[model samples]
Target: MTTDYNQIANQYKKAKEQPWRTRTELYSMMNLIGDLTGKSVIDVACGEGWLTRELRKAGASEVVGVDISEEMIELARRQEAREPLGIEYRVEDARATESAQQFDISVSNWLLVYAHDREELGVMCRGLANRIKPGGRFVTLITNPALYTWQSHPPDYRKYGIEAQLPESAYEGAPVALTVHLEDQSIVIENYYMPIDAHESALRDAGFRDVAFHNMTLAPDPQVGDEGDYWDHWLKYPFFIMIDGIKA
Candidate 1:
């Protein structure tokens, strides 16, 4: 199914007030990447430029955020104007970025999953690598596919005899509402699932080397659960996996 960029843009605009778990994961991953002072960075598929803004605050000299959604880019531009973060937000497909061999670092968070095939992923990595100097870093975050299948169970035809299992939570709890496409009176939504091996292999084939996988676990909070609950259950079995590699 085609993703409706307008719907995604609207969600991002509203998400500014919500506490997104993925954003916290991205922040932790950024810290692990070390200092960004004076660095030229590109945030690929940068929806609403939130992470791009954070990168600018981390001392990146020039931060460019690109997304396929024009409305999202507009929102990002407005936010940049209000905050004056010296960031450039553009509406550009990740598979065809404009810059050529210019950026010091290129980062994509939870964006590669949008690629439906390996060839598309190769094109995106090539595009990202083309914009970065040789020896530059390409950091990406993706959901673990193994975790995905494990969380989503097959439909029991014998019991319910349904044609398809209505898409439900593929994660820990009930599936959250992901605005996919909106028509005059209805919206189409779907669940997202990914495997870590698919992500690593794609990066490797895209000419990235020394790839490393970092399993990220969120810190336990009183609202979520007890500390030991997170450490024992969630931390031991993280839902998100981050992969980093250097462009060859």
Candidate 2:
């Protein structure tokens, strides 16, 4: 099953305040991680660190945040002892994280869909390209493997509060679930379903390169309204998928 997330750590941190997670997965992973000032991030599966404290408030001179879930790194070390953005949480295991110092950017929003196949998605894409360095970069979000061709009807994401299910056929690892919807309760989370060419052949066999795959953006001043057409069915169909790469 492997979906313990430490007993739904605070219901997945209050379901990340679902609003399509900031209008679309943290605005398409911070606009593909444009700037981080001095850069040096890690954040793989960083559950309770809230984007690893927004990558050190986006000035990332350095930041860390792993998560094999020790109660979600103890609520990201209790919000870093209440509020001291020096981030550094860790419970480890983004496929056995082993950072010796090699970051410039290596986020992992959904943590490679929790790889259950394709050789554990190439050991989670070589542990997200061994924490990046060569050209540094790796942003992620994964899960839209064509969403299993929308098995029949499927498109109703509970008004973005979230909901997934899937699995009447599609296979490669299968097991989907998801479900967030938290206002009082509802946190599922159990992912797996890889095959966008097995995530671009597990990120070019773990060395990464220009790989790309994004589609979900909306927040150019969108607090949500009919003005944005209420995110037009989540911008057509994006349940999630934003992978980028570089690290070679």
Candidate 3:
């Protein structure tokens, strides 16, 4: 929760399109989201608003990008100013943000990973659910619970952006750090280890119905190229877990 992405924003943005993000995570999540034509979307923890812009290009009529980091918001705003997308960016905590259920869909990339405890998890889910129309969905791409808990080092972990060196080892709500290999450098950030059960409980308590998790796949994509088959071990354990929460 204390990770300073502002300090590494430029490096991260530059590496955001690396296979870990663009190829596997975003590629899978966007597939799950399908077409957004004519839909209004709210992107939580939108960071540089890259995905927000993509949503607009995908035909989202209106989009709002929210983040707790002012630096991230500033960068997002600057980009918007340079190339207008009509996307609104705001600095708001994911746990406390209030809206009038105006959005048709809510999506977050690495937002829930900041929840440090049950209370925070509950708050996040509630806030996400509250921002969307009834029956609307909250789709999140998160660090996979299975991979986070899996202790053994996979042979192809690095290929999938996982590091064998874990900063923390304990299970269930323990603070952990993940190392991501980028082109020029590596990045590590602290994220709480919330198990799948805990995530489900929090979502259910927050009034979400039919919480389903779609495991990340090694499905071929333009970004992945031909080496996808080499990382069978990576696909066996999901590096990212996609969760769909329907507001009840």
Candidate 4:
């Protein structure tokens, strides 16, 4: 199933306001990133430039946001026009992006799952790795491949208002739909279900070293989005996993 994100760009932006995205995934992704102070960063598949703006605020000396959808890039450019963060948004697919200088750090959030196959996944990984200079790092958060075997049992992260259980017919790398329940609405997004092993192999083929996975972690902050105790149940079952390593 080809997901034309351009059709759902607005909905995707709205979905980001949900706790699962604003709090859980964002916190975990940024945490795995450690620090961006004085780093040159690239936000791949940067829909609407949300992270591009935040990257500059996070202290990246230079930032670039890239997405394939012209509509997505246009929205990002609109944000740049309003605040003028000096960030650049290019409408090139990650597999085909280029620059004179590779970035010191590249961050992609919940993006790679869009790849339709292992070959495409390898292309994205290679492209992202090639964009990083020596001593640089690349990090991303993607749906946990463990869910592929969830033919019946579902992850116990309902408290966080998110859930995904593969049906009897679903297989790893197959298209899957996830419903994000926000305070005011519920939206579903399509993502290809690639297993973690496939991701690891792709990264390795792309020349990323020390590829490691970390479960989502909750910040101690009591007041973030809604239920303060939501993470208690959410922590037991990680819906997503963080993968990061040094660029080779």
- Per model, state how many residue pairs clash: 3, 0, 0, 1
lDDT per residue for candidate 3 within 61-169, as digits (tens), equals 8999998888889999999999998999998888775785468899998888888887888899888887889888889887766654554642237765556444445
Quick one: best TM-score, which candidate? 3
lDDT of 1 by residue, 29-81 (tens): 67656799989999988888878888888898999998888888998999888
After superposition, the stretches of candidate 3 with alpha carbons farther than 4 Å from their true spots are 148-156, 160-169, 219-225
lDDT of each structure?
0.65, 0.83, 0.79, 0.79
TM-score of each: 0.76, 0.33, 0.89, 0.89
- In angstroms, the error of model 2 at 51 is 15
Comparison by TM-score, 1 against 3, better one: 3
For lDDT, candidate 1 versus 2, the one ahead is 2
Candidate 1 TM-score, C-alpha based: 0.76
TM-score, predicted candidate 4 vs. hidden true structure? 0.89
Q: Candidate 1: global Cα-lDDT?
A: 0.65
Model 1 regions lying over 4 Å from their true place:
20-23, 149-194, 219-236
lDDT, candidate 2, residue 214? 82
Q: State, as a TM-score between 0 and 1, how close model 2 is to the true structure.
A: 0.33
Q: Is candidate 2 or candidate 3 better by TM-score?
A: 3
lDDT tens per residue, model 4, 126-202: 88987899779998889877765553356655556666645556465677777766677666777887877889999
